[model samples]
Target: MSAADTKAVGPPVPVPPDPQPTGKSSSDDAPRVQKRKRKKGELLPYFLILPAIVAIAAVYLYPLSKTVIMSFQDMGRRELWSGEPAPWVGFEQFTNILGDPEFWWVTFRTIVFMAICVTLTMGIGLLVALLMRKLSTWVRLVLTVALIAAWSMPLMVAASIFRFMADSDYGLINTLIAKVVGEDWLGHNWYLNPVQGFGIITLLVVWGAIPFVVVTLYAALTQVPQELEEAAALDGATAYGIYKFVTWPVIKPVFTMVATLSVIWDFNVFGQIWLLRGNKPEPEYETLGLYSYSKAFESTSFSQGSAIALITVLLLSGVAVYYLRQLMKTGEVE
Candidate 1:
């Protein structure tokens, strides 16, 4: 063989590393895409919900913060009229309210009144809800319409209507009673009689509050499975038995939630008493709500009034916490 041919060609030239991938690859873009997606997901809900957060802050948080700050201060007419900050007094306002015998009595009476009103409201509301469930379509429609009318009436309007109904001489109720029971019962002043006075107020409250509870409970009832109800009937369950065992379990949570709400509402009721009296209500019939209003505006001791309101908030919050604990036990929420 020729010498040149016999000398082996130089080892095959080595290939250069493939030019580092010049264009972006799908894999290289994956992390960026995932991060962008995560950021969007995190921000979208907050953006979507921003208006609701703002509304809550405006309607609830602002007033609550103001009340809390006022409760800790020695606020009065000067602060209210001038919109100036009041002097801080620590817990003195609370201490003063708590130390009063009359305040204790008022608290006790208010509790009793709230309990009665709430019980009546719930009982009537539950009854109406049950009735609504069984009613024929037309009847249910009429009843619903009536309930809506009652529910939508403004608080002041309702108070005025109730006051008209309770007038000693001209009220429709008094007129009817007088007609039925003779001249002796004529002109019996309901507002002056403690039993009748409270009874009237309770009736007014229950009448007004029932519509909401019934509507909520009826909506919950509609969600119940008809198959389970039918199965229960086939098992020879009585109507009441069906309700107690099969229906109640499904609806109890809503019932409990409404009841708690009703308690808070009834406890804080002020319009009924005030409007009924056309001014500050008589102390004998006063609740914490009315008393607070009178103290703040009438007496201009804003701090003491705010203190009462704070106590009411604490009470309701405690109730809410207990309701939440019960809800947790039922696994209604995480």
Candidate 2:
């Protein structure tokens, strides 16, 4: 049994049988493939959104950060060329702006103007919307077309149109007045005094804004249940009562949202005033927007201008804070 026989009779080394395929190999490959696909699926949304994120960062974030940093620093003509960071002045620009009486006056004027413009625009818009609800379909179509045209008109064009309409010699209003009343009122300046000037500007802004208000409010009005008004009316409610209880509440949220937007817009109205006054609107009627522009470009005071802009933004944020908090709490916006 020893060495000679070992080759012939050695305990059979069990040559391991070739493993049978359980078909698990193909299934295992399938799971790996599925995992790869899952990874790809997870990454696809991010890839889709990456371009938007990059675009936003480039357009909004970069400029916003630059403006914010520029506001805090003494950025001027030298920094514009030197390509170096300007000296950081803690609140000096802010102080200069705050200390100026002209800033205070402009701030007050802006608030007043915003209040008046928002009121008139919303009021007139609401009236137009209510009228639209009662109008014949054909008339509604015509009015809607006209409104779309008005709304689509550029701000500069609108301002120019209004300026011509309110012009001293060849103005439509004065010409009509002269034809009806007397030639004495024909050559009168519609924009002579600051009060009159502001009024004219307000008229222009409100005229432009009303179409938007009419469209949004009219849409909201259509959504309001007519049955509620009828029910209230049938229950011996007066017209005023029905409107007060039924119509107002339904449109209140939308009205509020639109008004807020209007205030924000009108408060920062530069193009309207600038173009209306032929680019030299009296300082008395100027808003913070115009003030900032005058400082940054006209006076070459970029830091001060940035400070004023920051202030304006802060002020608007303050106005919107309540609505924003309410929106967040409700998880809804009108």
Candidate 3:
């Protein structure tokens, strides 16, 4: 305990203060890290969707934009003398389409054709789908294969086959009719009359369209909850009643989708008509679709043809908007 020893010992060492964070607590730091990770995770989804968005913009939007632009310009064989730069004729094409009696006639025919084809296809498809649901697995498989085979056939090939079958001289239809009616069925052309031609076209279109609808409806039907159906049955409802109350409501969305797709397809129908009637505007059976093709290629009125196409687009778009609104309302109700 000498003075020298006490001085050497000095005061007890002071404890060092804990280090402080720059601006954040440990808890705050944890949240920041988590937020950064979440931001990264959110970006991954957009990156995945970017390719699809780009592809759609390139493929669909670009062509649609071109069509819109072309529809506004008077770029036809007759209009070439106007200038290298086709003059902007605002809505002249639209006005022409509206004014033309032939356009109106074709539009009416198109609507009637679409209505008949869509109704028949949907009805037959639903019936077939219902039948499919009750079938044994093997039978269902066979039927599905057969249906897909029919659906997978090339459109041109199908049309050619149908044309052959419908021919006046060598057609299976005529042969069958002769066998039954004891007359020369091959003496007259089936497609010479507009009504008969349309009937045959309707049959062909319906046959081609039904397979897709059947597949879609059947998938939707199978997804219906068995529990709901059974509960419906227990409530003393008949089979039809159960279906009406329970199944139909469940399948309504799918029905709407099918109907919308069918309408679009029907509006754009050109191949079938072209195959049946070579480019000529039939006296009573010209559709807007066929009319557009004939104008563009056969008549060589590109601007007018483009105008017809735009009119068809507008018509279909109106229909689509109506159905989309209905679909949205249905979603809200559900």
Span of ten consecutive residues with least summed lDDT in model 2: 325-334
Give the alpha carbon lDDT tens digit for every residue of 1-334 in model 1.
6768757665468888877877999999999999999999989989999999999888999888989999999988888789888999999999999999988888888899999998988888888888888899999999889989989999889998898998887788878877898866667788787668888888888888999988998998887788998999999999998899888988888899889888888888887877887775788888898888878888899889989989988878998897787777667542
Candidate 2 stretches with Cα past 4 Å from truth are 1-54, 326-334
Each prediction's TM-score against the native?
0.82, 0.81, 0.83
lDDT of 2 by residue, 1-334 (tens): 5787987786777898998986767767988999999999989989999999999888888767777877888878778787887899988999888998989999998999999999899989999999998899999999999999999999888888899998998899899989888899888896778898888899989988999999999998987899999999889999889889999888887787788889889988888889989989887868999999888888877887888888888998976886676556434543
**For every candidate structure, what is the RMSD over all alpha carbons to the true structure, in angstroms?**
4.2, 8.3, 5.1
Question: Clashing residue pairs, candidate 3?
Answer: none
- Alpha carbon lDDT of residue 263, candidate 1? 85
TM-score of candidate 2 on Cα atoms, chains taken together: 0.81
State how far residue 302 of model 2 sits from its true place (Å). 0.8
